[model samples]
Target chain A: MARSTYTLTIPSSTRFLEDARQFVETHAQEAEFADTAVEQFKIAVDEACTNIIEHAYKGNEDHHIDITIIIDTDRFTVRIRDEGESFDPTSYKEPNLMELAKKRRAGGFGVHIMRRLMDRVEYRTRGNVNEVRLTKFRNAEHRRNGDQA
Target chain B: MSNFSVGFRSSNSIKVLDLQGELDAHTASELEAAIQKCQDEQHYHIIVNGRNLQYISSAGLGVFMAYIEEVREQGGDIKIAALQPKVFNVFDLLGFPMLFDIVETEEEALSKFHDAHEEG
Candidate 1:
């Protein structure tokens, strides 16, 4: 298991979310991860990109999202980068199903979902660029340790 | 071009929507629009058949959440049925089973609607 990295760049629009999903599906499968892990990566990556497109870029198709997949012996990592607005982790609140339903809201689920599916969801801001790294452990023991990510 | 579509039909007075293709941020609006049409027509006893639906994202699930409370308030409910295991897993991950009447088959969902009508 040499560390292998794959990258894809898509415009900041919802339309390309499917493309981002397929990109993860293809590479994750190629990495020979279990079907369940592959599915998890596909969804976590989709949620991350959906957040970047909807909230960070704010529907501005002029922006682009940079996705880098790093396959390591211990983990499968996805690094997403955007030059648009940075996400404020402190402002994020766990969504309550009843509260969202009462408000008739359609969003606020992407971040929660991304964190749910990935073993580690880390966000950082470097200058004007924002990056979020979503990682899933390659081994069962490691995955169990990340059960709460 | 969008790779998703919603087909509308009726089964025993309950509106059924056949969802095909991937449902994500790009395609959630179609489901929302379809559900909206059902709501506007006062057809709240809705069954979403996900047999042919191969993929889904949180945005897709959000559509159901956004409308479920409203429809239920109107004395109607959105029932999801026949989802592929992968899609159902996503719903489960979000605790949707607790909030939604997710069944294994469309007939199962239809019967629930019928059962409710009988009780009412």
Candidate 2:
């Protein structure tokens, strides 16, 4: 008997990470997600938000990103849209750790971690808009008992 | 997706644990359970080799803090080495350098352990 959604718009900066964390934490608590599950959900969402702010905005500090969080009976989904140039996350390949170390790069690990932590991650671009969708199941049964083959 | 992974390897009385992949809230539990299992088995004197670690969130740091406290209570020590710059930045920002003994290489950690042993 749950059908509620919350919306939040904030600057594309790491300073907004607290707001994004609160958004996920609130919905997960409402959905009765286990504390561990809620934690993962928050971490993943924060990474996504950070990615938008850092990569899409390119540290401009002027662009604003819109993030929407929707909570259902068994799942929580966060959708982020930015007015920056279109980009595709699906094309992002997980870099080899050895190579990254050799190059002495500290970035690019954010997207890779997001994909590993979230239940579902999708990216699409349409008409000068870049969108990334993240979804996570709240119920343990839905998560452990769900189809995975 | 575990927050951390620990393995005990003996290189002349120095124990080394290789930590790989992301260490965050989602995966930190696996690390906790694994560490608890090790404690249950009475394995102590730990070194975390983070050569393969890609990212670590605040929750991940919490996991390390909890384990370090437990180890200390039992008269053992925990050390860290090979942290990437970004991951190290997170640790440094959180003031971990003051709380934990962090080294740059596995050999250095072992040498420091030797010094501690001799001093004690």
Each model's DockQ score: 0.81, 0.06
Docking class of 2: incorrect
**Which candidate has the top score in lDDT?**
1
TM-score per candidate: 0.96, 0.57
TM-score of chain A of 1: 0.93
- Candidate 1: misplaced stretches above 4 Å? A144-149
Give the per-residue lDDT digits (tens) of candidate 2, residues B1-120.
133455657666446778777775455666677667667867667778888887677556666666776677777777889898767866665556876888888888888888888998
Clashes per candidate, residues 3 or more apart or on different chains: 0, 3
Per prediction, fnat is: 0.73, 0.02
* Candidate 2 chain B: 10-residue stretch with minimal lDDT: B1-10
